[model samples]
Target: MSKETETMKHNAEVAQFRFALIAPVIQGLFPDASATAYYKRVSAAPLMLPEGTSVKYSYKTLENGNPCTAPEGLIH
Candidate 1:
């Protein structure tokens, strides 16, 4: 397959995984938030994790369920 087709497939997979990961968090935080509302809120607000949050390598692996590097500038 072409590189463009592979990239598209990879992106689609990532989008699906991201949605799945966020769904539970959204529901927990905003019990009444529908999928539409969740998307809207996600578009509007960024996650501002407060200070003193520890970084866990296991959590990163769990999030992607694959071997990947944690995003830079994530901890402030």
Candidate 2:
């Protein structure tokens, strides 16, 4: 693939990964305080990627990237 194509594909994958990581919290089943705690707990652990490597997003990053938290954006 071309460099641009590769970068786009990687970005798409990362977005999907981020969505999956925050899916539970965005479902609106939890109270606001619970959601905050959930993010902290999730950020405290490593996430397993599709390729099997683990990575973790910090609480701020995850919360900032969450679709529901954003003022405007397509949620998934």
State which candidate has the highest lDDT. Answer: 2
Query: Residues 1-76, candidate 1, lDDT per residue (tens digit)?
Result: 9999988887776556554535554346545345445444444533322232333333333333312323431121
Task: Assess each prediction's global lDDT (C-alpha) against the native.
Answer: 0.44, 0.73
* Model 2 stretches astray by more than 4 angstroms: 29-33, 48-56, 71-76
- For residues 1-76, what per-residue lDDT tens digits would candidate 2 score against the true structure? 8999988887788778778767888787654477778779877888887557888767777777776786533233
Worst 10 residues of 2 by lDDT: 67-76
CA lDDT for candidate 2? 0.73
Top of the candidates by TM-score: 2
